[model samples]
Target: MKSPQALGLALIAALALSACQDKAAAPEDIRPVRYIVAGGQAEIGGDSYAGEIRARNETQLAFRVAGKVAAKLVNNGERVKKGQPLARLDPSDYQLDLAAKQAQLAAAESDLAQQQLNLKRYRELLAKQFISQAQVDAQQNGVNAAQAKLKQARAALDASRNQTGYATLAADADGVVSQVQAEPGLVVAAGQPVAKLSQDGPREVAIQVPENALDAVRRAGGFRVTLWKGGAPLEGKLRELSADADPATRTYPARIALSGDSRSLQLGMTAAVALPARASGELKLPLTAILDLQGKHYVWTVDDKTLRVSRKPVEVASIDSDGASIASGARAGDKIVTAGVHLLREGQRVKLLGQ
Candidate 1:
């Protein structure tokens, strides 16, 4: 019933609407990219490692003789001077042993005295022909044996007395008790640790270095420390480094001595250590960002304003464990694409992540 012109016009309008809808439904062509700004010179900084403040000397205080602990005189964190009593063992047994030894020594001395008088009388009797020379000699021998026994007994007594003295635990140096392993009423063996002492001396920072960074750490020029509570950057120097790696952590233990204004440093306080990393001549880049096409290496660099990437051919230098060194074509501060090198074409638009 409608006219032919009206029908054609309606068809045209419907086709135009469909074209506009299809255009609106098209997806965005921008590629998501991750990039890093290259560094021209390899300067190591901003690497902070968690460490602990420690004294220069840490000693394990142990008893020299085995006994049941009687009383703990000083507890953990107690400060003590040299020869200070830390704990006491039950001295009842030691005292009893000492008394027995003393009694034995006294009896031996009495026997020795009696033998000497008898030997003297035997010599006089021999001179008067009342006893044979053999008899006199035998009496002299008896006296010598008694004297030997007395000496042995005296030595035993001294040993027993020393054992009695060992019942009291004493600090060997001025220090602060860091750990207490034995308490009153606990039986401990000889040379078993009863407490740990942090000796009064220089302070240092202890840190663990991973195997990959071990060489760099050893070659570090110096170190700096910052306390966890926040303070000025204090100077530090490497004092000790382990020759072998730890079995469990595979890390090497290193000690850095605190140099300036370290009076406020406390033991066991958490700290951060920054060691200067040795710089190499060439610049470093992520190994994944490097693409090898027909033996020629290339890296995709991004333009800041256009957000577009262009493949730049680069000469390969020595490759490192973490990244490859750029010999030529790329310099520091240049923005380079780190991901999806093969999928990206030259001059393609990209949307930076988190931008």
Candidate 2:
């Protein structure tokens, strides 16, 4: 019903109204974030390290001679006393060797006796001037050679007897059989472990500690071990510490000797070792505060008066549950944005909540 000029004017008015509404609905440019002042150092309880129970004197019992295993005298977990027989090899070969050496010795003895009789007869003949001196001297030489052969044979017999005795493997100390490596009818070589014996003595807890915590562990005046099952804490002392770090884990292997009664502890039990963790002189920030820009690490630090955020480049020493420990680029009293860091731009204004 309106004319062309009137319709155009109305359309312009509507457009102006929509533009005003859009301006009113525009989002705020400043962002709100939560941050923590980095000054107060974090409190850390003793570092927990996982370890296993072991024996101080774990021994491996092996055979001294190569042969087929004829008998296994003890089973796994069996208690044994010193000099107890744990396994035996087939003695047939060793016994036959001994018999052969004995026979050779007896023959040598008989030869020596005959040669002595000949020497005596030669001496008598020479005294009567019935035989030449050279003939008598030859008989004496034969007697001396026969006696040397007898001595050599006797020495070989002793060695053969020792070999026969070696066929039986015996425990060197009081222990409990923890493992069996061979069985009856299985052939084993000399020095091959047939069983593992855990000697009945001091108990040890073996653990691998990170290189960073090694110095703190060494300086710890005392130690305590608690079972993973939540048993009473057992007093402990460092028994052995490895000088070299493990190549794969980059950790040092150490052992703690348990004091008092360790009868409740079992082999292969999981344990947690509590060691004092002092301030490592590193600033720990929340993991959310760290932002990776390219290959470098960054965080948003809030200004005290301006309430503006500035991007801070920080070097992280270690990352754990507490957060990332900063090695540099951040000081003890700096304020770092913990949340909504990605949405913030450098030099942008921000409102600190609970300020």
Top of the candidates by lDDT = 2
Clashes of 1: 1
lDDT of 1 by residue, 1-355 (tens): 9999999999999999999999999986889987777773332232557899998899998999999998988877888999999999999999999999999999999999999999999988988999899998899899999999999999999999999999998998998999987788899999999899998888899999887777667777788788888878888888999998889988899899988656467888999898764364446787888988999999998898988889999987877666877889887778888888899998899988731
- Tens digit per residue, CA lDDT, model 2, 1-355: 8999999999999999999999999976788888887745343346778899998999888898999999999999898999999989999999999999999999999999999999899899999999999999899899999999999999999999999999999998997899987799999999998899988877889999887777778888667799987868988888888999999988999998999977556788999888755464557788988998888999898899999899989998988765888888988778888897878898999998832
Full-model lDDT for every candidate = 0.86, 0.87
lDDT of 1: 0.86
**How many clashing residue pairs, candidate 2?**
1
Error of 1 at 297 (Å): 4.2
Q: Best candidate per TM-score, number?
A: 1
In terms of lDDT, model 2 sits at 0.87
Which residue pairs overlap in candidate 1's backbone?
40-332
Say what the RMSD of model 2 is.
6.3
Q: Model 2 Cα displacement at 167 (Å)?
A: 1.5
